[model samples]
Target: MNTFRAARFALRAKPTASFLGRRTYADAAGPSDKIRLSLTMPHQAIFKGTDVVQVNIPAETGDMGVLANHVPSVEQLRPGLVEIIEEAGSTRQYFVSGGFAVVQPNSQLSVNAVEAYTLDEFSIEAARAQLAESQKIASGQGSEADIAEAKIEVEVLESLIAALK
Candidate 1:
């Protein structure tokens, strides 16, 4: 009977001793330290499990900046710029045609976009011309589906133009 009691006490005490040395949330590493990022599109993978210091995404809820240890969330991205701050402190920007941004619990950010491209890859003149054409169709007496498609194009083009500026 005494041996059974001693064994129980030892097991309970061992757990308490380990728990006492455990670090609290406040004592843990900073959230802005670093995070793994994977930015992908249909045609190419922009970032393949790369470590980045920060990432600013244009989510439907609002523009949000994510860092290491960010709260896990699945956000609907808007057609706008996705800025990635690399480990070397250089910032790279890409215009995404709307998709999703997923922040995992394990300090990982995955952004899957319908289309993404650098600003220099776009021509301002071409965008402006397309914008004009889209606006004309959107406001014209076209079919409902055609008008809706034109409106969507207008929105995306406007975002792209804003990012290029």
Candidate 2:
């Protein structure tokens, strides 16, 4: 049997056994329940299989909060802030360029982004200068591709600036 089929069979055979090798029952979720979050970039793994209380993501559809037992869905992320509420009641925010967020059936959220940085890591002056340059290039007589790229940069910079505020 294929690996996927075998896994499916195993899951069916054991309703309480999740794909993450954890056992979960169909019980009413509570605030104490934790969701495993995996936030990854190309070169870094921000939160790898870490349990958290909640996560607020900036999806293309809209901003949504994910908690344990959230309905399974995939969301395309936009350039904005991702707020993670840790188990200890502390919140951390990161600015992600763009990516996808997947809420799995097993109380897990996986976020893959092109780029991500903490709010403190950004320099307002530098971002403002870059935004100005990108705006100029987007309005200038550059190639269509260059103009399009600059426009995307402008969008990201604007979002980053807003997040920094």
Candidate 3:
């Protein structure tokens, strides 16, 4: 019984380095060569002068975007959408209901969002419904705080729907 340590898949600038992890590799880049990304756990990473992203839930507020060249920002991220444009030009979108993003220019992006889900796995209809519902809540009897939160929800759902395409 071989207990696997990690399964990493990195998309290099070209098509050369693909997947790298474990011993039994099936691609040209499978944990064999030295790839730039060192990721642990799915859809997240620690600050190794690299990028970090995350997602989660709670229906707190809205969505945010954090890029590598983001000017070292600090903000309280409300749940919604997290778009990741890899160095390889590949875009990976996530839905985050609540969390925050810490960014640095040409360096890294650290995202900690509550309840994040990949846009590729997102449901458009569901997102649309959520958007509509949140909009209503935000516009209806929500307090200032509630409205702010609903706005975040709407943004996140809308962003997810857009990214899925």
Candidate 4:
């Protein structure tokens, strides 16, 4: 059985070079390349120079996808989900409050958000309750500043609900 297992492992192994069991820099930026992504929030860095196949972000202009060698540009993000496609064909999604996404030269992407978390981290019941409260405050005869803050809260909660779907 041990010999059979060793043979199976040998058959599954490839000749590609790896570093610490991770893909090498050359592999990440090879001819069939991936973009290096840096997704940062105020309190945490979700992705720190990680290589990915594509990234879909909700920008104020519109929803956009960034791929390797994409044009360098800056986009103001809206409160929504950011999807990251990795080299292994797995995808990660994060809900960001709002911020900026900058596609730098040499296939580098940087996203700085006010807050971010995975969709599973959110409680839909809590969001719905808050949304209802925000709506009430935004529509009521509250102070201008209070109404404005409530409106913003409503917008963010609505977006989060939409993303959860």
Give lDDT tens digits, candidate 4, residues 68-146: 6555678899999999989999999999999999987577889999899999999999999999999999999999999
User: How does each model score on TM-score?
Assistant: 0.80, 0.80, 0.43, 0.80
Angstrom error at residue 66, model 4: 0.4
- Residue 74 in model 2: shift from native, Å? 0.8
Which of 1 and 3 is ahead in TM-score? Answer: 1
Worst 10 residues of 1 by lDDT: 18-27
- Per-model C-alpha RMSD: 12.7, 8.8, 13.3, 13.1
lDDT of each: 0.81, 0.82, 0.46, 0.81
Task: Give the clash total for candidate 4.
Answer: 0
Residues 1-165 of candidate 1: C-alpha lDDT, one tens digit per residue: 685555334322313333333321233433436778999998899999888887889989778777665556799999999999888889999999999999876778899998999899999999999999999999999999999999999999998998888
Off by over 4 Å in 4: 1-32
Top-lDDT structure, candidate number: 2
Worst 10 residues of 2 by lDDT: 11-20
